[model samples]
Target chain A: MEERQRVRRPGGRAARVGAAVHQAVTDLISERGYGKFTVGDVAARAGVADSSVYRRWGNLEALLTDVALTRLNARSPMPDTGSLAGDLHTYAANVAREITGPEGLALLRLAVALSGNGQQGRRALDDLLAERARHLQSMLDRAGERGERAPDALEVLDHVMAPMYIRVLFGLDPLTPEYVDGLVDRLL
Target chain B: MEERQRVRRPGGRAARVGAAVHQAVTDLISERGYGKFTVGDVAARAGVADSSVYRRWGNLEALLTDVALTRLNARSPMPDTGSLAGDLHTYAANVAREITGPEGLALLRLAVALSGNGQQGRRALDDLLAERARHLQSMLDRAGERGERAPDALEVLDHVMAPMYIRVLFGLDPLTPEYVDGLVDRLL
Candidate 1:
């Protein structure tokens, strides 16, 4: 009886619902693009009550922000290959896979759209950037501790992250292993 | 009589209408964002008949492509200050200003949104990229002629243009003169 009760905990159910809603939001944005769907649509797709989404996220923008932040957090953790160069290469490759993955472009577009969308949206974008920056900083900090002269976080952002993102967004070229390594090499 | 006839020529009126329509489209995109407005809305804002827009551009995506291409062509001509470094610095500064300008973010978001939309949108994005690439190639060619070992156009795009675009799109730090120069210096 106790085992069954633990399995049916309220927190577990809530988490399952949250995952479903996030997935639904991603799928909708991928298929239909941003600003075309409503909270009700998301709820319908996730098979949850509309009020549940509203109670949790407050509004569509908040919900979108949550989805973006959650996805960023869920991406592969920052690498620790014992050398700055190896770590950067692995980190860049992970990012390349995520952004070029099936739902990557949609999330990227969501971030861009949110930034331009007035106050709340801009705040959401800032939060998203802050999270990514935090992860990058930790990696850089580790390099610093190892007595390696690591480039600043901004350098990695400007040189490595920015190019990969722009290329994917524009469909310019494949983010091949050679190309990803080339960015890390240049930055180093 | 001849001057009046020239002023009132049909082609002159058509050009005026095109300008108004383009401005209307840009303004709408800036204010409301992509996919939020319609052809009728654009025509109403531009003070033209709906049929007029349809006859000229055929669809919203085409109209958007035209706006992006036209704006790219209308930017300041490629600078030839007798050196690749000078040319890249000036060019990066110009891009920084344009992308940070009042209408810049909206246009960029439009480009991103269009790229993910479908086949037509992908083609439109390709056209925009090709136009920009042509201008970049000309500047590189000039440097080659001067016996300066110029970096290829892709190098410039990857190092300079990509960083600026990604920065502006995410509302990151301002594209300061120093920052723009740093990208050029690194590329050279």
Candidate 2:
């Protein structure tokens, strides 16, 4: 489904270049792991000059962060389903699908690796999570205003949204739609 | 509170050695990041032979994993407040306190750096999260049995437990007790 969506999305030259670079990085990370791969390898795979890659991203971590952010942004936004349960189910399913997918897992694996180092890596991960959380929070707030969710909409955001990443990134059990639905029904 | 609890748990020579080595690695990683640190540094700091560190944990990643897991286990268990809201509030507060603390942030930063690289690093992180989640799940299950929580306990776990980590790890707003209480009231 995500593959189909990516295929359908319009891509311009810069977007294409970004996509190519990001894909190259992803392929390398998935195949060789982070420690073994280098910016030079990324440059070669993307068919771009090392200088260009460095000029755009400054470092390997920054380049990976850009790729992660781009991939994260490409995910489907939360939907309004009238009821809290309905909205939560939609949100959970979307998250479950993404996290369970190859790209999401790859990013998660990358994030966990990068999270342990310095402030730059930490900030990059924090920014990615915050972006997603803010989006989910906005949708949740709408649900609250419409009387589909509780006054404290962030509760659903925390409980419903955070676990998918935890499970997927940590390589725990696969997050199924049923598991998400059950969570939404009880929590919301 | 964690300081008090650490004093209570006593162990043998191997456990002591592991603790020493773990602390050494953590300190090194905190100061120098994983990319620049090595087994020799960990050994020298721990006052153990270099081969001993390698024999016990294989690589720096494995050594760090042991350190993280041991430190995590040393924290106080969640209090059973007999209400889902109360339990969640306490849990969130505890998590908030940990994540905001110097050591917690340091570990999180380290995990991010290590997560980008190897399968071992990823698994190590997953183990850490799973250990914590299991603890939360046990508490939630107890709440459910007491009729203080929803029938579907995992929902409460996701909504209540997951978000606390999200906010702290991302370094967003401080996760206050009031926020946790609000979340619990709405979701539980």
Candidate 3:
């Protein structure tokens, strides 16, 4: 109650601090994987006092979950790239790039680690996947309207998206433009 | 170094202890998710001292990775079900079963958590996925031998296996036997 009132009081400074902290979380995750970070690390990176983070999000996993939500929001409402394939290719590329990158890789690790814990982490993961599915489905629907080919949204996600993730997450194969293109062609 | 010497000097007590520790790891991971576990928990569960686990595996992550390797070994080398569809159905069932089960889910979460930290955990995950791909490839090869249709190993993984995992992991859909059959029919 007190925290909510403080944020709503004025200037939106609390909001800015929240944003900075989240951004710092992203940068840190991107730079190093999630295993090595601490709340103090996040606080120092965000230029906020350690107590400010404790006062706000209360803990590391919660803060990280909040950060993941923001990242999801920033990435979502998938762009209309004309065709489902185009949207998928664009979308997959973004995901591929993020996971393969140092920061994104860290964030993904944290997500997996979180998956083993409580409902909050698992829900975040499920929601993230479902949200992407919704956006991807919109593009497929658009493709159908255009009289182009379209598969079930889930089918495309499973066939294309799952393998892409398996490969990227495991380093089983290079997540290349060629690989993404191939996934698009085969699925479509 | 001393521990290795101690194991070598024994009447295979080391082997028994090792197996017990690994089993305890699996049981705990299955009962709860990996997040709630520690070397101490594993030690107690195994009826071994914490120092035993510490001396053998050195850290929680290392122990977890070793446990993952064992699970992968136990799960792989799927039977020759005479058709790619049959083989995949059998194989995917094993995976779906594991992921849905507490043990498998915990292992997966661990793999994802490790994905960001070091190459060791990531490599274990990669090897596990690749091992499954190889077994799936054997079925594809057999299909080719019979002049039956076959896709590339990676494609098979992406289309057949990927969709199965996406559903099982995300709960986007049910992982019924009928569902696996449907996935096989579509991909094949």
Candidate 4:
């Protein structure tokens, strides 16, 4: 499902170059987890010059941060199923499906790793996490529009997201619909 | 903080060799992260014969699994304050401390990566995750003793644990005591 959806496009020749490089970044990341790719590898794979890649993004870490930030901006279509709980369940199920797959888990594990990098890397990761949090907040706000009370919304968000991630990244259990429903029911 | 405490002692002769090799495993894992260590490295670092290390653990994955399981057995001292929420609160704070540190995060990331391994590798990680779940369940059971009603405790457990791990592993935010206090208060 995720494979069919490419990174959302930006305009112009520079955007074309950016899209090409980002595509190479995603492919290499999925093919070989984090810590294995280099700027030269991304350049060669994207058919862009190594100098162009380096001139554009400084180093491998910067390129990864750029790709991650760009990917966040092209965010996946979020669930909006009337109630906050319903939306979160849909979101959890989607997360479970993604994490259990190689590509999704690889990107996430890579995110966790990059989150630990020094300064600029940390800021990039912060933006990425905040992007996800915003989706949760929006879902709850929609619930509020429907007249449901969702005070302490952030804590509720934690209950919804944390478990799905733990399952996806840890493989403790199958992310069955039953499990996600149980979580949504309990938290709500 | 973790550097101050080694995996607790198990027993004699074979135990001595096991301790040395496990120590080597921890050090190499911290320094190089995953997929970068070898049996030969462990053997040389632990001053054991390479043949001995191979005979006992067979391969790197198996060795990692063994080391991780042994570390699990020497689990952290459980938080046992009178109230269920109080104990969970303490537990969450301790978890925040452990996970934010380099050594703890390295081991956990390694576990997540290894959980994707085939058969024996998966089983080892499964056992490791189950062991932690058992600790949480035990805490809930004790809460039951105090007559605190936590229906569907596994989901409740997720509410308790998921956010902390997500924050620590993803660097989403600081795992402050106040943050943990919020989780406990919201859930209980």
Most lDDT-accurate candidate: 1
Task: Give the Å shift of residue B44 in candidate 1.
Answer: 2.2
Model 1: residue A56 alpha-carbon error in angstroms:
2.8
What is the RMSD, in Å, between candidate 1 and the native fold over all Cα? Answer: 4.5
Error of 2 at A128 (Å): 4.4
Worst 10 residues of 4 chain B by lDDT: B1-10
Q: Write the number of the candidate with greater DockQ, choosing between 2 and 3.
A: 3
Cα displacement (angstroms), candidate 4, residue B81, comes to 6.0
- The local distance difference test score of each candidate is 0.87, 0.69, 0.73, 0.74
- DockQ-sorted candidate list, best first: 1, 3, 4, 2
TM-score of each: 0.91, 0.73, 0.85, 0.72
Clashing pairs in 3: A29-A103, A30-A103, B30-B103
- Local accuracy of candidate 1 as per-residue lDDT tens digits, B73-150: 677478889998899899999888888865887788888887887898889889888878998899999999999999
As a TM-score, model 2 comes out at 0.73
Q: Kindly list the per-residue Cα lDDT of model 2 for residues A1-188, writing each as its tens digit.
A: 35634655467555666677899998887676555678899989998888878866789988887777777777758788777667668877887887676666776667655565477777877787778767777776787688663634455556666777655644556787677776676564
lDDT of 2 by residue, B1-188 (tens): 36644654468666687778888876876676555678898899999999988876778777777776676666647778877667777766776676666577666556554455467777777676667667777887887788664534455555655676656655557777777777677665
lDDT of 2 at B75: 64
Worst 10 residues of 4 chain A by lDDT: A1-10
Model 4: residues with Cα > 4 Å off, grouped in runs: A1-32, A35-60, A78-100, A134-148, B1-17, B35-56, B77-94, B118-120, B138-153
Give the TM-score ranking, best first.
1, 3, 2, 4
A51 Cα displacement, candidate 2 (Å): 2.9
Tens-place lDDT per residue, model 4, A123-183, is: 8888877886787678778888899987455665577667877777777667788887777
